[model samples]
Target: MFPKLDPILHSELRLAVMSILAGVESAEFSYIKKQTGATSGNLSVQIDKLSAAGYISVEKGFKGKVPCTTCKITPAGLAAFENYVNSLKEYLI
Candidate 1:
């Protein structure tokens, strides 16, 4: 029997964040918040989790004196995102 797959990247917000990061090279916090329609607090928390997991890299800097945070999906994150898609296929079929 196939092993029970771990349920990771299942939350809607986190998934959204991952999906967005998957496509972009790197995006700023405001860009993600605008694209995902997620609140600042929620996005911040999720990004922190991904960063801690080594799935994403987070950078903080200034964009013309404005505070900016950028997020990029690491190779591990891409792999997990692919696995997440495969897991959903199990449910779909």
Candidate 2:
């Protein structure tokens, strides 16, 4: 049987995360939280999961004296999101 969209990837927050990551060079953690309308704690947890899965990269640094964290989607992540939509298209047809 063909693979379906993974449950982990199909969640609203995760899908939104991947979609936004797909568009930009990189985004800050706070930026993602703002755009997704997710709480900071929730966004942090979801991003960590994506990072562990090798779907995205997380970088921690400082901007001036303040702390900063950024995220970018990996090639694997982009491919997975595309494939997930394709999987759903099969059901839609």
Candidate 3:
């Protein structure tokens, strides 16, 4: 039997966000939005979910006068992502 996938990272948008963070030290909200082609409102909601799950850390600050939100994956998140990938591989066998 295949291992269960993480419901939080299962979302396409949330998965996309995690995938992006998995490769980098961090990413700005706008960059994630641009890469995922997601609207600000939707992205914010998804980000909140990830943050609430302790899968990602969000920092709200400012680039000069403009507000900025940055996200980074936590160790727990990386483990979860790796586990998710391995579990998904079970389906291919």
Summarize candidate 2's per-residue lDDT along 1-93 as a digit string, tens digits.
566777768889988999899999999988898899999899989999988888899999999999999999999988888888899888787
Ranking by TM-score: 3, 2, 1
- Top-TM-score candidate index: 3
Q: Give candidate 1 regions above 4 Å deviation.
A: 1-6
Q: Model 2 segments beyond 4 Å from truth?
A: none
- Cα RMSD to the true fold for all candidates: 1.6, 1.3, 0.6
**How many Å off is the CA of 66 in candidate 2?**
1.2
Worst 10 residues of 2 by lDDT: 1-10
Off by over 4 Å in 3: none
Query: For model 1, how does the per-residue alpha-carbon lDDT over 1-93 read when each residue is reduced to its tens digit?
Result: 443553448778888999999998999999999999998998899889888888899999998999999999999999988888887788777
Question: For model 2, what is the C-alpha lDDT against the true structure?
Answer: 0.90
How many clashes (backbone N, Cα, C below 3 Å) per candidate?
A: 0, 0, 0
- Pairs that collide, model 1: none
Ranking by lDDT: 3, 2, 1
Q: Which candidate is the best by lDDT?
A: 3
Task: For residue 81, give model 3's deviation from the true position in Å.
Answer: 0.5
